[model samples]
Target: MSLRKQLNDILPTLLPNNPAEAIKGTELIRLARINLTGNYSDASLRYHFSIMSCDPTSAIAKVEKGQGYYRRSEPLPALSGAQELLAWTQGRLDDISGDDSSVDSAMLRIRKFRAVVTRYYEVNGRFPFAFRDPFTNTSPLGNLWKYPELVLVDWETGGSPDEEMSLDGGMLSLKQRLGIAPFRLHSARLRLSPSLMTYREDFFQTLSVSMWAQGGELIYAGPIADEALADGLRKLSAAYGVGVTSFGMTPEVLDDLPRPANILNAHPKETEAIMAKLDIHKIAAAQSRPHLDWVALNSLRSESEEADKLVAWLNHCIDERRAEPFKDE
Candidate 1:
């Protein structure tokens, strides 16, 4: 049997699933040798490990921004990811035909991506408020057009990067005195993949959901590798004023990320390591408006409870003369 075959059979048992607990190549080779045949040298074993880790079906995986190997969990089927997203958006959950394992894996990736985006923006000084209810299983079909998955608030704050900042009092006062809104609201639509077949829906959904906000953005977990897709997104963004960006999360890297809870609660060091894995690319910049569409925003109050909470939260912060990360409670 080939060494790759032997490693394929042997590595799953030796490699840990968690990336943080990945076994270094040196140690993995040592353990793998006990079960590997043909007396492979360390260099040969290392080379095999490197090559095999790149194979999606292989039991082993290399961390994207770190050393060592971990067990690569089985990914959501490549072709089905978009289909699943479609079924989800249409609220036809019954149409998504997958076994429990695959469905759970798909949902986990969606959640981890959300957690990653939330943390990414927060650390970059944008406060993200997720409208979870609109995307939940209980939501009605076509809600994607009616509600954004996230609303990112960019506030003018004065403070060090290491600490949560209070709103810049002078800026706040000036905006209030001038009767201008004190923040930029960029509504965002998050998706696991960016595909030619689905980019239009993604872009239009982002635009529809953010009609009331100052700007809109379509964010994808995976990189935008296809030039035609990039061009298409750029054209739509140019015409419609929506932003398009990717977090550079390939399916493999996404599967290797920590679970949603751990990601959301990541410490500064852990968050830093995770952030290092991102390759943020801006396909197009969102055009901001000088003012929000108040008449359009008023229409949402009849549809989404989240819309009310969003308004109330902003009012609370403005009234208190401070800016802070949101707490659900």
Candidate 2:
């Protein structure tokens, strides 16, 4: 077999998924030698590593800040194909002009945008719960109308979500007596770009999914540069109370970012550096409701395992009277 093909088959198994755990070139070459067809010089293998890491199709990836390589995550197959991608892009309403070659590239961009948003919210004190099953390959397109990509939880006491913090006794009691939720939940729909034509669908989808929550937020990867788009979004938000915010990460910027795992697990300094690239704009603020829609939530929990997990996580935290980041056991 050709060396490139051999590396492709072997690298994914040997490499770590996270950049922090990336293996050095020399070590990786030694590991690859075990499965390689013929004796290859270290220099040749290193050169191949350097070249293949640049290819998005290749399984190997170099660390953004250091000297090592890791596995590049495969694109999710849920919404593959250029036609499906352009349907969601923020360029134009009728702009499904791209060819079929952009499926993997577009899917990777979507994954990166999601990771950045998740990390952004996590660091900013809101615990984010992602809805995955609804976007799986086997799921229906109508799921977009019913499920949000993310739901953000903001605790009332302003405690560290990284560790368990005691809920305030008096404040908790007061809210309980007043028949109000101790925390505010906001459902969010995430998109790669913002377009003048498709902003309403985005707004309403956010509103629709958040019907059971306190509020809804429509978050975009790119900035809201077009005034008309911003105006339209603001008007919708005013009428419906859905929040809109832009992270200012264009497709090019998202492409330049590290893998999802690296971004989520970056050091404090690295995280700050990654965050520095964002030019966040809150186009319209969300209106919060006092309590959750139990009827809607009860119905949703029956449809989505993620919903049940979300509720279980929240219940566990409340039962313990402590706030901590959600973790799957």
Candidate number achieving the greatest TM-score relative to the actual structure = 1
Q: Where is model 1 poorest over a 10-residue stretch in terms of lDDT?
A: 75-84
lDDT of 2: 0.76
Backbone clash pairs in model 2 (N, Cα, C under 3 Å; residues 3+ apart or in different chains), count: 0
Clashing pairs in 2: none
Candidate 1 per-residue C-alpha lDDT over 85-196 given as tens digits, one digit per residue, 9 for 90 to 100: 4354344555667586766676778878888999999888899987876665555656768788789998877676653467778889999999889999999988887665
Error of 2 at 251 (Å): 1.0
Q: What local distance difference test score does each model get?
A: 0.79, 0.76
Predict model 1's lDDT versus the native. Answer: 0.79
Per-residue error at 253 for model 2, in Å? 0.7
Question: Model 1 off-target regions past 4 Å?
Answer: 1-91, 159-164
